[model samples]
Target: MHVGVLGAGIVGLATAWQLSRRGFQVSVVDRAEPGSGASGGNGAQLSYSYVQPLADPSIWKQLPKLLLSPSSPLKLRPQLDPLQWRWGLAFLAACNARTSRQTTAQLLTLAAESRAAFEAMLAALEPDCDFSATGKLVLYGSASSLEAAGRQLELQRAMGSEQRLVTPEECIAIEPALAAYRRQIAGAIHTPSECAADCLKLCVALEGALRARGVRFLLDCEVQGFDRHHGRDGRVRAVLTSAGDLEADAFVMALGTASHRLGRRLGAYLPVYPLKGYSITVDVDPASEGAPHVSVTDSARKVVFARIGSRLRVAGMAELVGHDASIPATRIETLAAATRAVFPQASRMAALHPWTGMRPATPTGVPIIGRLPRAPRNMLFNTGHGALGFTLAFGSAERVAAQLAS
Candidate 1:
């Protein structure tokens, strides 16, 4: 079967990879090059074990700060658009313990599968993307929060996640870069099997591999609409694009935030919104001081730092203010400040490359990974991965390919 996968981000590329390997002809369509969206500048942490959803019970307490404080890690500006209000209401509805834990459980399963699939792909291709399995530390600032994390740790343990609560001293021993900021640390939860890699380089590698396997890429191609088949009920024969009507036996809507509008055209409702995020990549000098080899996430600030080769990727902040692509100066400064406070000497501000991308988020934080009810038989979904797009791409790709095959 011939399959046309929309969006050239990691998810679409991975889906194309899976389908091609399964003996299907594949084509990737995107307005830009692969990994040019959220995949290019994400958190870079392959958080396999710490797959917690954002709409946890804790968000209830921070609702005020989320609205009032501009400096808060999560920013929510009520938009005039109805979809924003709808998405916000659903997100608020999901802010409960039971629902949060349920979402976490599902995310953990998908993340585990993604890790396995990602590893298998890495072993086969051996792409030079600064891949590392040095593990990760999620630092809590208070003893109370540390205790709270312990309860969630137990739940994850039951789900087969190898996580452990570590003391501030032990955290220092595990990652010496934390020594400078030792006084602020209350405790940390460490996951030894977590990994990190350069997502953009990985996407480039996937594109190269897919090309070698006879897969086509329609870069700079805007998908306007679709040409429907009248014989089949709501079946799409081809996607009408700026390039032309590219016919295919099957179609996969892997366009992240853009999937919602496209789905509406095809009579599907995807509760996907753009949760904007920011990141700053800084050049590091290893000889000067303690450069963190292990990935670190500041739980209080919701900022993450990962060492991808000589550059440190510092990313954080979740803004729900519609599709405003402007990168504010303060947001960039916040990430730069986080880098200073976390690992002072890890990077110099001279070469800080600031970037912003809208994460295609769902209210529940769990990705929409299969064909929806209203979607055509040939239509499938692998979008709405939100911030975990890089982490869950391979596993979702595997599932979507399997769904098509069945």
Candidate 2:
């Protein structure tokens, strides 16, 4: 079978790799290079315990504050776009306790399944992506915050995540670099089985592996539309790309944020919106204090820290209602400030590379992974993962492949 996978982000790459491994002739098309989108510049967290949905009943109280505070983790740029208003309403609707609990359950299931698939892929490919299963520690700034997270931790634990609450002293013991904040650290949730990796490196390695496996890549090719031919059975024939028309027995839409546009063209109105995020990577001098080994997420600040080799990556913040990819100075400064507050010993923070990318977010946290109900039978979707793209890539890919095979 010939399969055309759209988008070259981690999700797209993983789907293509899995499909190719299943003996399908796969051709991946992307306007940009591999991992150039959200997959490249994320927090790089493979945290299976982070299954909580973004919408919480408590968030309603914080929304006014978030809207007022420019440095707040959640920011909504004032815009006249009707889609933005619709999305905001949908987000508010998902903030109910019942919806949040249901979403959390779905996310936890996908996270665990994805973690297993990722381990299997790593064992098979042996990609040098700085993969580490050293676990992740989520820290709260105040005892009240920790108390709140404790309930979430219990929910995660009940859902089969190896997560446990730890004291400030135990947190510092597990991650010695957090010693400076020991006094301020209220408590922590340590997920022992969670992992982290260099997402960019992994995508590059996977692309190379796919090439070696005879998977064709149509780089710099923009997909204009699909070449629809109504057969006697009323099935669409092939995808028409910018290069030319290519026949594929099956097609997968792993286009990340761009999936919405393609879905609309294919008569499927996906509720995926582009949520922008920022990150800064600083090189850690070996002569100075080494970078963090285990990834850390600051629940108070909503920032995540991952040490990729000798570089420390800090990523967080969500800006809705803007397609502008330009890096905002305020966002970068906020991330840098959070990093200094957490890991004060890390040196060379002045010189850092800042980047911004859009997360393909749905109103509900659960991504769309099933076959398009209205589209041709061969067309499948594996998009709208939002901030969890790196965390859920492999499992989503496996599911997409399974759907295609069925």
Candidate 3:
């Protein structure tokens, strides 16, 4: 079978790899290089314990404060667009206790499967991407926040996560560099089974591995639109691109934020919106203290710190209702400030490289990974992952492959 996988992000590449391994002749298409989107610049943490949805029942009360505070983790720039308002309403509707629990349960299942799939991929490829199982630390600066996190940790533990609470001293023992902040540190939760990896290096290695496996890559080719050729049996035949037409027995739409636009063209209405996120990578100076080996997420600041070799990356903050990808100075400053607060030993702030990427967010914080409702029988979708693309890519690809084979 000839399969055309649209988009070259982590999800799309993983799908292509799985399909090719299944003996399908796969052709992957993307306008940019592989993993150049949110997959490249994200915090690189494979947090299996982070299954909670972004909109909790209590989040509605905190929304006004989060919007008013400049330094707060969540911020929404008011827009007059009706789409934004509709999405907001939908988001609020999903923030109830029942929906939150259901969403978290579904995420836990996907994340666990994803972790296993990632381990299998690593064992097969042996890619040198600095992959580590050092676990993730969630830190809190205030006692109240720590108390709330403790409750959340209990919920995660109930969901089969191997997470535990740690004292300030234990936190420092795990990562001694955090000793300086002992006075300010209240507590933390350590998920020892979680992992981290150099995402960019992994993407590059996967691209090379796919090529070695004879998977065709059509990079720098923009997909203008899809050409629906209905056969006598009323089945779609081919996809028309700017380069040329390609005949495919099957097709998968894994185009992250662009899925909405492409789905619209294909007569499918996907509720995927662009949630912009920013990150900064600081170059570690040889003379200064080295970066933290473990990944860390600050609950209060809503930022994550991931050590990728000699570079320390800090990423967070969700800006909804914007198509712009420009790096805002204020956002960068907030990330830098959070990084400094967490790791005071890091220096050379001016040497930081800042970037922003759009997350294809669904109002319910769950990815849409199923066959299109009214599209051709063989066409599928694996998009709207938002913030969990890298975390859930492998598992999603496996599911899509299974669906196609079945």
Q: Lowest lDDT 10-mer window, candidate 2?
A: 227-236
Tens-digit per-residue lDDT, 1-406, candidate 1: 9999998999999999889989999999999999999899898999999988888888989999999997998999996899999999999999999998899899999998898888889988898898999999999999999999999999999999998999999999999989999999999999989999999999999999999999999999999999888864789999988999889999999999999999999899999999999999988875766679999999998899998988889999999999998999999998988889889878667877889999999999999988899888888999989889999999999999999998
Off by over 4 Å in 1: none
What TM-score would candidate 3 get against the native? 0.95
Q: Write the per-residue lDDT of candidate 2 for residues 20-93, one digit (tens) a residue.
A: 87888999989889998898879888878777778788888898876788768888776887767787789889
lDDT for each candidate structure: 0.92, 0.85, 0.83
Which candidate's lDDT is highest? 1
**Model 1 Cα displacement at 106 (Å)?**
0.6
Candidate 1 lDDT score at position 310: 85
lDDT by residue for model 3 (78-105), tens: 7886666777788889988888878888
Clashes of each: 0, 0, 0
Looking at candidate 1, the ten consecutive residues that score lowest on lDDT are 282-291
